[model samples]
Target: MVATVDVRHETLRRLKSGTGKLATAALRELDADYRWFGELPAQERSWVGTVAQAGITSFVSWYANPTGTYRGALEIFAAAPPELTRSVSLQHTLSIVRTVVKVVEDNADELAAVGGEAHLREAILRYSREVAFSAAEVYARAAETRGAWDARLEALVIDALVRGEVDDDLPSRAAALGWKPGPTLVVVGRTHGPLGETQSAELRRSMRRAATGAMVGIHGEDLIVIARSDQDLRELASSIMESFGPGPVVIGPPAVTLLEVARSARAAFAGVVAAPAWSLSPRPVLADDLLPERVLVGDTGARDRLISIAYDPIVRAGGSLQETVATFLDCGRSLELSARTMFVHANTVRYRLKKVSELTGWDVLSTRDAHVLETAFALGRLRDAGRASL
Candidate 1:
C-alpha cells in the first residue's frame, strides 16, 4: 500500500514536470475530435483551444501543490472572455476537460521514470476531480446569470401587458423567451402571495400542463397567464387555484387576443381590488361576477357593464317588468305589498318578477341579484329622465 501511494505521488511529480509536453499532446488529441470542434463558431473554437491549454497548466500546478489552489481554481474558466461560456455549453466544456484528462492518463507513463498503470491512473483521477468541480462551478454561475437575465426580461414583458403599454419590440422580445402570444387569452388574478423560486416554477408548470401554448409572466406578486385554449377560464382558474394565496383569484373576461388583454387585465384587477366587498366569494371568482361590488368601488367599467346588460335589456323590453322589479324591490320584496301598490294580485306580481329574471338573468328573488337590479333600475331611470349621463 505504501509503495502504491509512493508511485502515485511519483506520477504526479513526473506529470507536473512535463506540463509542456502534456499540453501539446492534449491539444493535438482535442483537435482530432474535429467534428464537434469544427462545428463551433470560430471564436468558440479559439476559446476551446485556450481553455484546453489552461486545464493542463492548471492541473500541473495543482498536482505540484494540491492544497495551494488559486482563485477557487476557476482561473482557467475565467481566463477566457465571458462570451466563451455563451458560445460553449457546459456539456461542450466538460467534453473538452474529458479530452484533456484522457490525454494525461494515456501518456503519463511516457513521462514517468518507472511505468505503472495503477499509479498514474490514480494521479489522473485525483486531478480530474478538481477539474470536474471547477467545471461545475463555471456552469452553475452561468445558469445563475442566465436565470437573472431571463427574470428581468420576463418582468418587462409582464409590466408592459399589465400597464397596457406593449411596445413594437415586445413581440420580438417575447419570441426570444419562447413566448407565442395568443389571440384567445384572459388576464387572470395576480399578486397576493409569497412567491419563491420553487412555487413560481410550479405555478408555471401547472399552467403548461393545463394547456399547450400557455405563457406566464410575473412582476412582483402579480402573475398573468395567457391561456390559448378555449376552455372555461373560471374552470381553468379553479384548476390552478393552488398557485394563489388565501384570497380571491379574479379571472378577467376572456380576451380574443393578447393585444385585447388590456380590458381583461383592468377587469381582473378591479375585481381583485373589490374582492374584499364579497366575503363569501369563491376562491377563483369571475371578475364579472363581482360587478355589483366593483361598481360600488368606483369602477366605471363595472357600472357601465351593469347598466348595459341589466338595465338596457329591461328598459328595452318595456313590458312593465322594470316597473314591477322596481316596485317589488322597493316594497321590500313583498309580493303582496307590490301587488297592493300596483293594484294587482300577488300572482300577477310573481309572473312579472319571473319575466324580469328571464330577460336580465338577474333573479329579483335573490338578494344579491336584486341589489344589482335595483342599482341598474335607478341608473337606468336617471339616464332615461336625463337626470344622469351614465
Candidate 2:
C-alpha cells in the first residue's frame, strides 16, 4: 500500500498545479482524490460542504490542515466568503476569521484605559460569544491589564487630594473635587434653548477659567460655585451671564464659614423665591447685603413695644422704613448727609423726617426724640431680619 505521507504529498502537488478558482480547484482536486476529503473531521467536512453551497471559493481550503505548510498558498488564492465578504478573504477564510477573533481578544488595553477591572469583565461577556476560538483567553488578558490601569488612576486622584495639590483657596479647591462644605453659593439656571452635553461641559469649564479661585459644582441641573473672595464671585457671575446670555443668576451670599453656608443659601434662595418675576430675565441677585432692607423690614417685630410703637405703620407701607432710620442715625441727624444717602433733595428728606416725628409725636429736632428714634430703628431692623426667616 502507498504510504499516507506520499499520498498527502501527491495531493498537495495536484492542488498547486490546478489553477482554477480556490473552491473549484479544491473540488476538482478532491474529486480526483476523494480519500483526502474522507479523512477530514466531521466539522471540517460540514464546513466545506456549506462553503460550496454558498458559492464561496475561499472557504473550501479552510477544511485543510490549518497550520500546514500549504496554508499560505491556499490563503493567497482565497476569494471572499459568504457572510464574511465584508470581513475577510474567501481563499484563506479561516485565517481571516482567526484575525477578527484576535482583535476583540486584544482590546483589554483600550478598555482598561477608559475604566478597569469592572470594564474588563464586562467587555469579555460583551464580545466573547461573537468571536472565534480562544477569544475568551484574549479578553481575559485585556481585562486584567485594564483593571490595573484603572486602579492606578483612582490612586492618583486620591493622592492629589491628600497631597494638597489643589489651589490655595480652600472652598474653591474643595468644590472642584466634589466636596460639600458650609458657605456655598447655589446658582440655578435653565437654558433658554437646547444645548449639547459637550457645550454644557465647555461652558462650565469657561466659567471656572474666568473665576480662577472659585469652586464650582453641579447639582441636578444647576451650577453651584463657592468663591473665596468678592472679586472671584463677581467674575464668576459675569462669566456665566456672558456664556449663557443675559439671564439672571440667583446667588446666596458668602456664609461666614462652611457651616454657615446653609443659612446663607436659604437667605439667597428666599430672595429669589420672593421675586418670581425676575426668573425669566436672568439677572444676578446677591443674597447677603443686597436685600438688607427687606430682611431688616421683616425683622421689625423683634423690637420691644417702645420701638414697634414708633415705626410699625411706616414699615407696613412697603417703603423701606428701616433704611430711613439707619440713614438718620448714620448722618448724626444732619439733614445734608441723610438727604444724599436717601438720594432725595434736602427738602424731601426733611418731609420724611417731619412725617416720622408726626407718627410718634416726637419732635424731629429734640435731643431726646433723636435718641428714641435711633433705638427704635435698630430694634425694628432686627425684628425684620427675624421675621424674614419665618
Candidate 3:
C-alpha cells in the first residue's frame, strides 16, 4: 500500500505539467474525426472543451488520491457554465470523455515511466467505468423525473374527461401520452392491491401485446380502464376481474370518440357504485344491463336510458306490443293469463311477445328481461306525467 501511494504521488506530479497539452490533444482528435461534435453550437462546443480539460486534470488527481477524487472529480464538469448536460446527451459526453481517456492511454507507457510502481493504465480503466456509471445515473434520474410528471398529466386527463370538462389543451395533453383518439369503452372496478413487481410488469406487457391503446388509473378505490372500442370489454374485465378486491367489474357503453366518452365513464362509475344491489350480476357486468340497480341508486341517466330503450320502442310499436308485455309480466310471465287478459289466443300473445323481442330486444319470456321492462314501464310513466305537468 505504501509503495502504491508513493508511485501514485510520483506519477501524479509528473503528469501535472502536461494537463494543458492533454486537453488540446483530446480536442484536436475530436475535431479531426467526430463530425457530430463539430456541428454543435459554439457555446456547447466550449462547454465540451471545458469538460475535456476537467477530465484530464481530474485523472491526474484521481491517480494519486483515488478515494477522495472519485466522487467530487466529476463536479468540475457538473458545475460547468450553461451545464454540459443541457444540449449534449450523456452518450455524446461519454464519447468526448472517451477521447480524452484514449489520448492518455495511447501515451500510457510514457506516463508510467514517471514511476515504476504506478499502474497508470489500470487506474484509467477503472475511472473510465465509474465515469460511465455516473453518466448513466444522471440520465436515469432524468427519466424518473419525467415519468413522475407524465403520471400526473395522465391523472389530470382522466379527471377532466370523466367530469365532462373540455378545454383547448386537453387534446394536446392526450397527444403527449400517445393516446390515440378513437371510440372507447370505460371499465370500473377495484384494483388488486399493490401488485407484485413481476405481475405489474406483465399486466402492462400483456396490454401492449393486445395492440389496444389503454389508459389505466385509480380513483380512490376504483380502478378505471379506458380501452379502444374494438377491444372486448367483457374479455378485458374478465381477465382482470380477479384483480378487483370486490364487487362487479362494470363496463360502460362504447362512446364514438374519446372526447365523447364522458357518458361512458360516468355510467361505468355509477354502475360499479350500484353493482352490489344485484347479487347475481355477471362477473364482467354491463352498465346498460344494470339499469334497475342504477335507478335504485338514483342514477337519473339510467332511468332515462330505460325509458328510451325499453319503454319507448314498445309504445312506438302501437300499443299491442306494450300491452302484451305488461300483461305477461303481471301474470308472472304466464302465456295463458296474458291471453285471457287480452281475450286472445295464447298464440296471439306469443306472436306479440316475439314482435316485442324484435322491437326491443327484450323477450317477455326471460324473467330478467321482463323485470327490466317492468322498471322501464314505471320510469316511463313518470316521464310522461312529468312532461304532461310541464
Candidate 4:
C-alpha cells in the first residue's frame, strides 16, 4: 500500500509539472486540425487557450484526489466568458475535449512513474469523460438562460405592436432576438390553454418552420404570433392555423416591414374581438374580411376600410351604380322589384348591379358581399351627412 501511494504521488507530481506543456500541445493540435478554431477572432481564440489550460489544471486536481467529490469540475468552463458557448457548439466542445485527452494519453509514458503509464492512461480516460459531461452541462445552462431572455424580449416586442406603443427600441430589441427586416403579419387566436414551457417550445418550433422568422406571445388564452416572410401571409397563416386552439384564427393584413407591424396587429386583434360574430368563417380568416363586423364593434379603421373598399369606388364612377345598388338592396336584392321602383327594365337593373360589382369588387347577389356593401353604403351616407353638418 505504501509503494502504491508513492507511485500515485510520483504520477501526480509529473502531471502537475507537465500541465502547461499538455495545454500548449492541445492548443497546437486544435489550431492545426480544427479549421474553426483557426478562424476564431483573436480574443475568442485566446479565450479558447485559457479554457484548455484551465481544463488541464482541473484534471490534475481531480487526478490528485480521484475519490474526492466531483463538484468543482464545472470551474474548468468558467475560465471563459458565457458568450463562448454561443459560438462554440457542443460538438465543437467535445472535439476540444477529445483532442486534449489524446494529447495527455500520448504523453502517459513521460507523465507517469515507472510501471504507472497504464494506470495513468486509464485515469486520463475517466477524467476526460467527466470533463465532457461538464462541458454539456455548461452549454445546457447557457441555452436555458439565453432561451428565457429571448422569450422575454420577444414578448416585449409583441406587446408594443399590439398596443401600438412602438418605439425606436422595438426594432433593436427584435433584432437582438434574430428578427430581420422583412414583411410582417400578425395572427391572433385563443390557445388550448396557457402553454407550459415544453409546449411553448414546440409551438415556436412549428411556427419557425412555417416562416422566415417568428415570435410568439401568449396573453392569457390569447396566442399571438408575429411572423415575417416574403410569402403570402394568408397562405402562411393557413399553414399554421392548426397550431392555434379551436376557434377563429384571425390574420391581419401584411405590413411591408417591421416598422409598419403595429397596423397589422391592431387590425388582427380587432378582428379577433369581432370573430365570434361570424361563426361560419374559415378557420383562419383575414382581418380585412371581417371589416364590417369590426365596424359594427366600433373599429374606426374598419369603418374607413369598408367605405374605401366598398363605397367610394361606386360614388367615384358617377354612373347609376350608387343609386341602383341602394334601390336593389332596399328592395331586398330583387332585380324585378328594384327595376319597378326605379322605373327601369329588369335588364337595366341587372346591368347596373353588374357594374356595381365591377366597381366595388363585391357582388350584390351574394349574401355576405351584399352585407358588406350595405354596411359600407350606410357608413358612407352617415359620413357624408356628418360632413354636410360641418
Scored by lDDT, the top model is 4
Give lDDT tens digits, candidate 4, residues 1-390. Answer: 123778889999999999999999999999999999999999989888888898888888888887998754378777788888988888988888888889999998999998788888888888888888888888888999998988888888888888888787888898887677777768999888888878888988898899856888888789988887788777888888889998888888877667567888889889998988887787688899999899979999999989998999999988788999999999999989999999999999999888888777889999999999999999999999999999
Top-scoring candidate (TM-score): 4
- How do all the candidates rank in terms of lDDT, highest first? 4, 3, 1, 2
Candidate 4 matches the true fold with a TM-score of 0.89
The model with the greater TM-score, 1 or 2, is: 1
- Local accuracy of candidate 1 as per-residue lDDT tens digits, 1-390: 113556557766777777777677776776777567777777787778788888887876765566784543387776788778777777778888888888888886675546556555665687777777878898888888976787677677667877888678887766766556454455556655767888787777777788655667765776777666667665766676666655667888867655666678778888988989988887777888889889878989888888999999887898788788889989998999999999999999999888988887889989888888888877777667885553
Q: Each prediction's Cα lDDT score?
A: 0.75, 0.47, 0.77, 0.86
Compare candidates 1 and 3 on lDDT and give the better one. 3
Q: What's the distance in Å from true for residue 243, model 3?
A: 2.1
What lDDT tens digits, residue by residue, belong to model 3 across residues 81-121? 53456588878878877898899888776666445433787
Error of 4 at 55 (Å): 1.2
Residue 301, candidate 1: C-alpha displacement in angstroms: 2.2
Question: Candidate 4, clashing residue pairs?
Answer: none
* Candidate 3 vs. true structure, TM-score: 0.71
* Candidate 1 Cα lDDT to native: 0.75
List runs of model 3 lying over 4 Å from the truth: 1-124, 183-185, 192-213, 228-233
Each prediction's number of clashing residue pairs = 3, 23, 0, 0
